[model samples]
Target: MTKQGAGQAGVGQRWTAPQRWTLAAAVLGSGMAFIDGTVVNVALSALQRDFGADVGSAQWVINGYTLMLAALILTGGALGDLYGRRRVFGLGVLIFAAASGLCGLAPTLGTLIAARVLQGIGGALLIPGSLAMIDAVFGDALRGRAVGLWSAATSVVTVLGPVLGGVLIDLGSWRWVFLINLPLALLVLWCLRGVPETRAAGEGARRPDLPGAVLATAGLGALTYGLIQAGERGLGGSSLLIAGLGVAGLAAFVLWEARAPHPMLPLGLFRSAGFAGTNALTFLLYGALGAALFFLPLNLIGVQGYSGTAAGTALLPMSLLLAGLSGVFGSLADRTGPRPLLTVGPILAGVGLAWLGFLGVGRPYLTGVLPGVLVLGLGMAITVAPLTSAVLGSVSADYAGTASGVNNAVSRAAGLLAVALFTLLMLGSFRGSLSAQLAGTSLPLTARAQMLGQSGRLAQVPVPDGLSDAQAAEGRQAVRLAFADGFRQVCLWCGMLAALGGLVGFLSLRGAGRGRQGGGAGENLHEPRGEEIRAGQAAPGRR
Candidate 1:
């Protein structure tokens, strides 16, 4: 067949049974990567206990994966472009499956963390390749719908991850959580056989920018580690110094990208005003989302005395709401444009977080947590699809995969940074409050020192001998008050971040109805079907 005929045939082939199966396989494979991100949080305590690691140390299992995924995602996109999306994606699946097995078999905390890092690399590769494959196969009109379906599938997995993890942890073992990925990976591999390859426009010209990749990975990893350690050690310590080095490395990367003959990330992409703005909004909004995901379960189980299942189940309503509404917002973006939803979504999220901030100790779940969650979910549903559309539309088609990868990386980084910063702030505030209370009491200096030393676990701390019943009761109340204040403070910060993101969205994002036609040659390449437009097609307002 002639090239023209072949091209037409390929487009038509997308609707066939084989193509549908291929798409389904790709979506499921990619969804598992996203699901694992949220799933492990539910098993955090169990992992820590089993491995006999401190809370801070155990957190690295999650942090390591996310940090690597965020750092390497763009590189993964570049790899797909250089090689073939199908090849890279399949290899990623194999690696992920292997890593999951290793994780399940890990007998030491260090080994587990190492396995998680490997899993992240695989995840990074899988995500961009999967999306790129969709872009390669689907036509413009169907791309959005395909993306919506893919997003919905991943969203469901994300929402269910905690509940699933909770069940496994409570009834089975934490290892089951990691072990579960093995079977899923095998299923994806089997399904992948039906998927065909679609080469990009300039496939041969694409090469991995190794220097840029190295700099970005080192910088991001160092920065994340520093931020995580900042909570335990003061910001001015060695950790901060390392973080500064990481920043320097990232700056160097930016410089290299600017000068490189074939840059991994084209420096010129930021010339698009709408693209830059949308990315900025992504960073902050995702940060807030990450913070909420990280903290909410802890607060529910730790403070509210809810069971693991109850805490996970509590998130179900919010997850369902988000799943139902994201597609609606995607369609609305196709119609009325993304500006209104983008502006309104973040504001609503801010309001919800602010309300949550005011929750006192022992507050009712219905009045405090559930309402906030509901509002947050609605806000997320409204904004996420539009945000994605804006980013993809702003760029040219040739760079769509890279742009998506970058935005995904930024959002993940934001979450990582937010988790680190907020945990520090919350823990610091709680400790300070406890210290102040101890100082105010009639207790002797020795007693005060002892109390302050055990402030970290005040709620569960053993009552000391020779203390009157009144004193014990007073100490308990003070500890409770301190924890309540800390929780409120953290929520307040979340509100501020959400509000700021909303403002950015309002100011920076142009309506899809009012953007430039095409910025560059690379911009208008192959438009993916349904929600999967080329990066250039993601221009602010041009649906």
Candidate 2:
């Protein structure tokens, strides 16, 4: 069947009891992955306390999963295309469940990090395969609505992650956060049996692009490691070397993609202005989003003295706003073109971040933080759906799975880099400010030295009692001032990133052009010949 016809037919299928159950399972699995992405931040301190590790060491819990997810998401999509989507989806559920169990049982920080990496691999497989399955099964009329529903549903779960994690940690222990995934996974697996398998187009001859995969993985991995190390080691010596090599390797991967007969990422897609703009915007916008998400919780708990649940609760308003508005934005994009929304969204987000930058210590949450979070949430809602539509709409049906995979990978990579870079900036500013403050203090030289030595843990350090009340009060004020300064600097950087993204998006978008109505650019691209298909197609196997 033609791609359009297939979509229409798929949607036309009655929502039978079995089909409904299957769809529910897919949504839960996909939502769990996205939710877990942001949920663990609130528990970082708890993890550190339980495991007797420093913040830097504890970060591996997040980095391990993010790195694996960012590196392998595109490959996951390709694997889904090679294997039966249903089969891969099932395997992903199994893998995710098993990994979650391992994480819950982990006795040390190292074991937890390892399990997180494995969980991420399963997540990489599940997200794209589930989406592709929805596309292959749903009809055209329902496709947009289904995608919107799926997006909305997952977003709700993402927003809830913090609250759920907080409750689990408060009521029980941090381990419950990981354990919660088990029952959800089991339910999904049970529902999976009813989803029909879609046959792979090139089942017999398809093989992975191993060289391209290796280069891309190594490039991102090295770059992230370098950024993380920069906070403590500075950008000299080994850091610079690793960073440079990463850039070079990434450049080589791009070059290789252009010439590879069956490239891992088809370079031709960049010919579409909409596609390029959307992907670039995705990278920048998401990078900013990730940075803000990572830092905001730290600021709330470390500087503001909020509990884990309270910090997570602070995020609820923004998350709720986003969940409500994203579907509206998607429908709007369908009716009007994506250009205006794309341009406006990032600009508003930039303004929000810039506003937050001005907030100092002792500022009330309602007066300072709420407005910024609200505005940023609205902007995110406006941008995300349209961006997804643009990328998927720019490619052909056969390559839909690939395009989705690439966009997802880029988004995750943006998040990974954002976390590393922003953490470095925040920590660097905090250290510099604290050091300067300590140097000029008139208190005993020993006290000043102690403060400087413990600067990284200033939030946790008790006010020293050797001095008068005035002196102790001054010391506390100094620490808060340093943290405020660092937080403001990071927010300013986020603002700059968002504004730059806006400009790039405005310039690159094609407006309401010939292909904007939505069958996509696939029909215009040349189809593979019989012999070419036999050689280039991916084989059917578990992702």
Q: Please give the lDDT score at residue 264 for candidate 1.
A: 75
lDDT value for candidate 2? Answer: 0.70
Across residues 1-543, which tens digit of lDDT does each residue of candidate 2 receive? 777676777665666664565567768888677667767877776776677664455666787787777777666666766877788878888888899899989999999999988998887778667676776665554555566566556656766778888888788988998889999988888888777776447542255566777788788878877877776578888887887888888898899888886677888877777677778887887777667666666667767767788877876776676667766887898787777788888888788877777667767889878898777767766776676666676666656656666766777778777877777887788878876765566566777666666654534434566987777777776677777788788888888888788887778875644343335444211111110001100000000
Q: Please write out the lDDT profile of model 1 over residues 351-380, one tens digit for every residue.
A: 777776666667888898889878876877
Residue 421 alpha-carbon offset, candidate 2, angstroms: 1.7
List per-prediction Cα lDDT, in the order shown.
Answer: 0.70, 0.70
Candidate 1 least-lDDT 10 residues? 534-543
Top candidate on lDDT is 1
lDDT over C-alpha atoms for residue 14 of model 2: 64
Q: Give stretches of model 1 more than 4 Å off.
A: 1-17, 137-148, 201-205, 437-481, 510-543
